[model samples]
Target: MAKTYKDVKIPEELFFNIKNFIEKYSELGFRSVSEFVNSSARNEMERIEDRKRNE
Candidate 1:
């Protein structure tokens, strides 16, 4: 299922933390911050799902 996009308001500190993470990860060849973060998240989810299925 596709997720719907929603406008979210995050606190400044949280946004800065996210930005800092993205900046560090970007050095490892990730293109956009959103793409990089989302992809990494999805990959972890998929791994968990696969593990559950195998078990």
Candidate 2:
């Protein structure tokens, strides 16, 4: 699938928390909070699909 950007609205507090995580873990591998969020979302979608398939 081709990638296109979409704008998502998250609460300010959650946004700040994610940014803080990115800053703290930058050395661990995450380049930015967006990258972390994207990967996490993709993994969650995969989990949902798998559960639906199993059911």
Candidate 3:
């Protein structure tokens, strides 16, 4: 099955910041800003879920 995706917009300044961070730390293995953002979003979702479960 094909995976579906959607666009999520962020402030332009924050986007540039992530771009710069990824460029500076190329060895971290993030291929693009979108990849980093996706990973960060997923991590945050898990963290929030865990916190709620513990409470």
Query: What TM-score, over all chains together, does every model reach?
Result: 0.51, 0.75, 0.89
| Candidate 2 residue 39 C-alpha distance from true site, Å | 0.7
Give the TM-score ranking, best first.
3, 2, 1
lDDT of 3 by residue, 1-55 (tens): 9999999999999999999999999999999999999999999999999999999
What is the Cα-based lDDT of residue 18 in candidate 1? 75
lDDT, each prediction: 0.75, 0.87, 0.97
User: Across residues 1-55, which tens digit of lDDT does each residue of candidate 2 receive?
Assistant: 9989988888989988999988877776887767888899999999999999999
RMSD to the native, candidate 1? Answer: 4.0
Query: Between prediction 2 and prediction 3, which has the larger lDDT?
Result: 3
Taking all chains together, the TM-score of candidate 3 against the true structure is 0.89
Q: Which ten contiguous residues of candidate 1 have the minimum total lDDT?
A: 29-38
Flag regions of model 1 displaced more than 4 Å: 1-12
| Candidate that scores best on TM-score | 3
Worst lDDT window (10 residues) for model 3?
3-12
For residue 50, what is the lDDT in candidate 1?
Answer: 100
- lDDT string for model 1 (1-55, tens) is 9988755465878667777877886777765546665777799999999999999
Question: Which residues of candidate 2, in runs, are more than 4 Å off?
Answer: 1-3
